[model samples]
Target: MKVTRLSSKGQIIIPKALRAAHNWEAGQEFTAVDVGDGILLKPKKPFPEKTLAQVAGCLKYRGQPKSLDEIEDAIRQGVMEQWHDRVDTRE
Candidate 1:
């Protein structure tokens, strides 16, 4: 078992051997959880950053895309339907 000491500045230096064994790099983040008996240090998993191109073809749509005017008109029609429904219910 390896031993480590916490500095006065609240910083703990993980032993070189343990760091090498775990393949942990400097500046790596960890989440500390209080386990009642002791603390648990878990390596933070990072989420991959994706661009629009990476997620572009995720949706399968064989139909041609609608024009901007058609899209706006559809939205307006939907909103008017919702507003009419609310007004009708109130009356």
Candidate 2:
């Protein structure tokens, strides 16, 4: 296991090996949480926040619209394929 210590400036220097292993770079943002006796650090999401109004219909379909039956068949086939894939992986 690796060890780290908090600095005098209320900052912690994460070890170089662990940093390289996680691909964490300088200025990486993290959210620290108190988990009972120890702290948990999670990387901050790297997405620019957007609302439904801002992103809705951005990927407009340009093809001819399919019937409701076609959509249902596609969904059913996708579910069956996924189920078979999962069952195969369990073996």
Give the winner by TM-score: 2
lDDT tens string, model 2, 1-91?
A: 8777888999888889988999999999999999999899988889977999999889989999889999999999999999999999999
What's the TM-score of each model vs. the native? 0.51, 0.61
Off by over 4 Å in 1: 48-91
Candidate 1 TM-score, C-alpha based: 0.51
lDDT of each: 0.92, 0.92
